[model samples]
Target: MNTIDEQLWDYIDGNLDAAQASIIKEKIDTDAEVKNQYEELLRFNLTFDKIELEEPSMSFTRNVMESVAIVPAPVAMKTQVDKKIIYSIGGFFIISLLALFGYVLYNSNLTMPGFDQKINFNFNLDKYITPTTVYSFLFADLVIGLIFLDRFLRDKIVQSKKI
Candidate 1:
């Protein structure tokens, strides 16, 4: 066991057993360092206890609730992936990527800028495959496909209602 300072302090605070308390009492009487450390900790704890906490404004909770009501609640993110949704999105992404890749391959082989033998890097294929062009195609296709799907679903719902 280490120094009895913690047990001594706990004993002072009435938080120790009678046996533990008696052991600390004997140490405190003989150990000058333990006695001084225990007194310092107790003084620090007493200082914090003496400081008062101010209560919040009377309408604080109400005002906070009112402000929160004015601000829209954050949309909860979907925790589980729907396989159909994943497949749809993945399919669209792959299709768009392949289309862009085909376009780049065609353009690069035909009339791409900075592709002249005098100006082009001899090794980097990224010279032909631009990220900006690929991303633009991907985003455009994704958005367009989503819009078309939404419209098709809406039309089906309307038709079913009529039927």
Candidate 2:
């Protein structure tokens, strides 16, 4: 027979084995202090369990559905021109440009303010495209490409192994 206060409390709360429960019941009936303690705990448990849960209004779900119904579904836009139509428009533009060029050649002002003075605009290509500049640019491109390739290969290997 268990006389420990915790064991007695457990048995009273319906958490004890059948044999243990009998022992606690015998103790509670015989001991006044144990009986009073058990009653107090039971009362607290019942009081908390009886507290009511709050409910929302009956129209809450209906109001939410009404709001959702008011909103319009998103619509997708349709294309007006296909590939053939785009090609036809491009052909028309080219033909118009050719006609304009022919008209300009046939009639244009041959005299200008600075017609006698020739403007010689020469850009030194050597300054920009040196051997060192080309090599450094190529090296930087190679490094960036290598980094992406390494990541792609690693991911492919992992996926292949998983499969």
Candidate 3:
């Protein structure tokens, strides 16, 4: 009556005492909903009882483990480039940067006029440009060009070596 509870299932499963089971049986007989729920639970229990556990053949597990062990583990390609070679290349760039910064600080000739020098403002870009600056620009461009060419040639040589 007061809505079917777990005690009803316990009764259906024969987990309850005779007295409790009798009480549930009386309620199930009187209540349509309780009767339907009990019957459904009974069918489910019967179906579950009919089901059997299946065991795989003994070799099934052994075969699976063997297959997994047979799978090759990935490996990293050992590089020909030495650690010292990489460090030297990085050190060279660092030294070059430091030298450039040192040169700029040494020759900057920055005078803080502070509005006293009466700086003449000129829009003429040609007067500000110098041969040394142009050559420096060309030198930097050439260095970059050489680095790219080296990379391209190195890649081609490596690829050819592979073949």
Q: Write the per-residue lDDT of candidate 3 for residues 25-140, one digit (tens) a residue.
A: 89999999888888888898889999998999979999999999999888788869788999999999999999999999999987776757667786788876789889999999
TM-score of each: 0.42, 0.32, 0.34
Selected candidate, larger TM-score, 1 vs 3: 1
Q: Flag the better candidate by lDDT, 2 or 3.
A: 3
List the candidate numbers ranked by lDDT, top first.
3, 2, 1
Give the C-alpha miss distance for residue 31 in model 1, angstroms: 0.7
Q: Model 2, poorest ten-residue lDDT window?
A: 1-10
- TM-score computed on alpha carbons, candidate 2: 0.32
- What are the lDDT scores of the predictions, listed in order? 0.85, 0.85, 0.87
Native-referenced Cα lDDT, model 2: 0.85
Off by over 4 Å in 3: 1-31, 74-100, 103-163
What is the lDDT for 38 in model 1?
Answer: 78
